[model samples]
Target chain A: MTNVDTILKDMIIIPKGIFFRGSNASPDEQPIKQILLSAFAIDKTPITNKQFRAFVEQGGYDDPTFWQPKGWAYIRENEIKYPNYWYDNHFNQDDHPVTGVSWWEAMAYAKFAGKTLPTEAQWEYACKGTDDRKYPWGNKEPTLAYANFAYDCDPTELVRSSTSVYDHPKYKSFFGCLDMAGNLAEWCLDNASTNYKWDRDGKDPIYITKDEDYHMVRGGCGLHNEDFLRCTARDYYPVSVRDNLIGFRCVVNNVKEEEL
Target chain B: MDILDLPQVEESRRMVCVCNWSIRRTWKGVRLATIIEKAGVSNTNNYFLKQISVGTKEKGVYESTIPLEDALSRNALLVHSVDGAPLPMEQGYPLRLFDFGLYGYKNVKGLSILEVTDIYELGEWERRAGYDKDGIIRPKKYWMVDLKGWGFAEKPGEMTDF
Candidate 1:
């Protein structure tokens, strides 16, 4: 195990263990269960246009190795370049969280960055933190200090948000990860699994199966209502489906020997 | 209403058979009784539920209602659990109303405001697209099916890249 702090400057360590997952209010969110996770390093925020540009400049679209087998076939078949929101082959701003990228695009970018999309369990573990606060800022209702949500900004204008990821201090998780609750609902590594198989006896359980078509996306986005702003709210779409409301953060299985 | 503050009640049922999106999904959740009780409407025993509206900030509204007695039934649910787990977004994470008697449109997703008013009105699709407001479903209920000509089967065109 390598020391996360020594190996990476921007990522934060989400300590491993049992974390509170799911919500009690919704039926699909029932069976509020706990699961164990191994320690890992996760990005402090969703990827920005500036970060994604490196992948694009590295010829991410043309490269085959960074992509999954089917992802390569799909993107190549469509001749896709840039995200869905990009116009004239350019993003609105360099610092804005990159939106309109499919799960495949986001996953490929994670590979290019030497990281992986956080698993659904890992993503939930990061948000739930030590105390399992409803929002990353705790049970408090969101204000401008919390998230870019509730249709507060124009959806069109969000791709060019002046709110750099670091702006929401209140939205930071207990581990010092910002935008874990809101920004753009991030893509996770797991395929959509409503069956939320709780592994109380197992360690670092990732709940996904091969037959799944939809992939999990957590955290809420700019145009969502306050109901979606909570940490427990889970979202998903077809891996190939691209939308302006979703972006993603990356995680790595980096554990420090000293901490271990 | 504060979701946490609401009187939490866990109820499971086997009746949900979503024809379009989900097929034979077992949904468990906090009871509509608990939700209405949380909304301080426990006194609505005799009065029928006229309109129960659930909506997102971006999308206008997805509204439907049930009779008071049916809304209070054990089978009907204000579901959050899909197959023994926390709901996912496209399936409505924090909450999704599961009215087994009515069609899927009444089982709204992305609940921001759940206004329970005595307003007997058709939801967005039921009125605009000519779906039967009183969508009753049974395997042999063929007569009711024709009333729902274009029914809630049509997906929204405005949903561009959500």
Candidate 2:
């Protein structure tokens, strides 16, 4: 298969279902609610360095059609020709998740790849599944074996860096997605709000605000403590701040006739 | 010089990370100015300070640089304790710099080497990881971990609002 075909084939199909979206973990994730979502195909792992390298080399940054107007303008203004860590040898491994991408860049990539970022509801549903597990891999606390987290005050371990996308198979989510609990937090489609404003039952709920506002990043990364790694945990960054702690995955919705 | 032997002062300050997290805690350490003065480095403005740490090989050794003036500022501290407790190993047990004016990267942890040089040097993160050279705490929305809430810093440089 071609590289694009292989990348497309690696997506995991999450069937349509009803799942609890939030938890009592934090005020932002308060008032646990059930959300219904259509079937969607999500990248099994985050977009890898190799996968995104194609986007960069294929003139992804140069193409305006693949980018939002704001994103296009921002890139042109700052002259952002590539991912922030594109040339950094430490983070640019073939199989490692690409980091240092802002939500706008991630959106551009998803558009370029013929997909879109998963909505916050979709992302959280796929993570917790029907079980409402505290973590993607279930309720057990995070360790180096389960996720690539910076161990809490562990003296012996020194460096904290993102490993290969699938370094820890045990970190898989309920839908058999890898690295959903850690590596690099994945950007979602929705803009971030201080707390959930959706009703208790909603379908494919997404809280989009002004394009320039902060956007949500789900899961956690190597630098975060266990609290941020919980399935219901929520964090966000301004749409333009491209730090190394965030990356993204693409999703293609399998819209059923009933939904249409 | 043993950092513990130096005279110390305790101050509560907000430690901000470039990654959008902040925490306010009491840190006890000797002021950087005191250490620099004791080392007989009187002409502080003529040089830069490089803070090096014993980080892992895979990620490269962690290093950060600051202007000599900022390094010798009253807020710059070589901290060894937090909240009445000695620093944990992960928190840079032996000695670490606490400069609230800059991001967490500039307050280098696991600190092992302190080099004073005439020329400005880019830090490890700045050289290899695409971080800003100065890493000043910029105005942004930050998750206040200790407060269990969110805060917006309206001003850039030297976050003193606890």
Candidate 3:
């Protein structure tokens, strides 16, 4: 019975620090900086919907050369076709989380699962672990049964499960990672105006600005709010936008690199 | 006429269609065509007005909508005073809604309920995901504005469809 995709296939490293990213309740998440992050490797959950329906049944959405010409002009100008609650028939269950993709379809399903998408400092150093916690399980105040937010139920239950996706000892993570704050709202490769300023020294300011088409989305969903699931909560769209609480997860820097 | 003495407007006719920016301030309200002609709108109805935050309950509830003829346009304005100082919980205060080519997230904020309906509602970040529900701006030369070393162009008889 070892299938949470073979118990989350490899790489979770993430060792890095200097947290305090943004949103002291917004002055556009004013000036809060101090980034630093270096070590990477994420993806413990999120990217489900039965592994993106096996990357859209192996064609990865009619392969426009594996996308990125503004994500094939936003999937040929929004004919998008699937993945936002996938026409909602409970989308083949198995622990949900895989909504209307599109950070270039989660970087083409992390380059067809070889792996690659974390980098907003490796997803805020794996959601502020090493004790920087604004969340990922710290700095309190999430409620709605401690995760899966927005009043947690009675919205006629669309997709629920958060008590045992791996023995929820309060959904672990001091680097054991499990449902990193709620469930859904991942996707990061940096480009939501790449701001740095964590003290304006020399290296750290990226905030990409040419022809900006939007990129950065980070943890914060279960309907979102505790200041957008904080771990420096920042959100963005336009990587050919798609939604339904957004979804993503895949970052194999290499664990016996089978070819990623 | 007393949503706390409404009357505040001017982020320049308020169009922020996700940052295309607009500005013309000097407002103070009660106009949203006088609250839909005092809530009597019924010309085969086609309304859309959401502006929550008095203890939001959820189901995509941040709120923002318009187009019942731009909320009965007579220069729509449920405002609660801005420049003359009264509306400021980060600029949405006790009242909000001041349209004119609407955008700035449909100028919604802290005004409780206004669901007049005819069928077309999905506000709050567009049904909790999948934004840009036609918050279309399309003038920045069809976006692609250069990624780093910035450059500029487009003027050779320019007419890229506004």
- List DockQ, one per candidate, in order: 0.03, 0.09, 0.08
TM-score of chain A of 3: 0.31
In DockQ terms, which candidate is top?
2
lDDT of 3: 0.57
lDDT of 3 by residue, B61-89 (tens): 47655566644543667777766878787
lDDT of each residue in A1-260, candidate 3, tens digit only: 34333434654665444565664544434576656654455766666777778878888878876666777676666577556667665433656677767688888778777677776655656666657667776777777555664432122355543222233347455566666555567777766642344336523334555323667677655554445566666656666556555676777543333222
* Per-model lDDT: 0.64, 0.80, 0.57
Off by over 4 Å in 1: A1-7, A88-91, A151-162, A198-202, A258-260, B1-162
How well is each residue in A1-260 modelled by candidate 1, as lDDT tens digits? 44445435577776667876777754445477767788998888778888898888889999999988888886787677777666523334776678878888998998888888898778877876769788877888877668776432224552334256777865577677887665678988877654455445546766665522567778776655455667777655566656566889998895765644
lDDT of 1 by residue, B1-162 (tens): 555455455643323222212234556666677777766886665555544335567766666655566656634566676777888887777777766666566566765555655655656544433334545432210111212211121122111111
Model 3 TM-score (2 dp) = 0.32
Which of the numbered candidates is closest to the native, going by highest TM-score?
2
Question: TM-scores for all candidates?
Answer: 0.58, 0.68, 0.32
DockQ metric, candidate 1 = 0.03
Q: Write one digit per residue (lDDT tens) for candidate 2, span B64-161.
A: 88887975663688898999998998788778987778888787778888888887777766654445777777665566788776666767776666
- Model 3 spans with C-alpha error above 4 angstroms: A1-38, A41-58, A62-101, A123-235, A238-260, B1-14, B20-30, B38-75, B78-117, B121-162
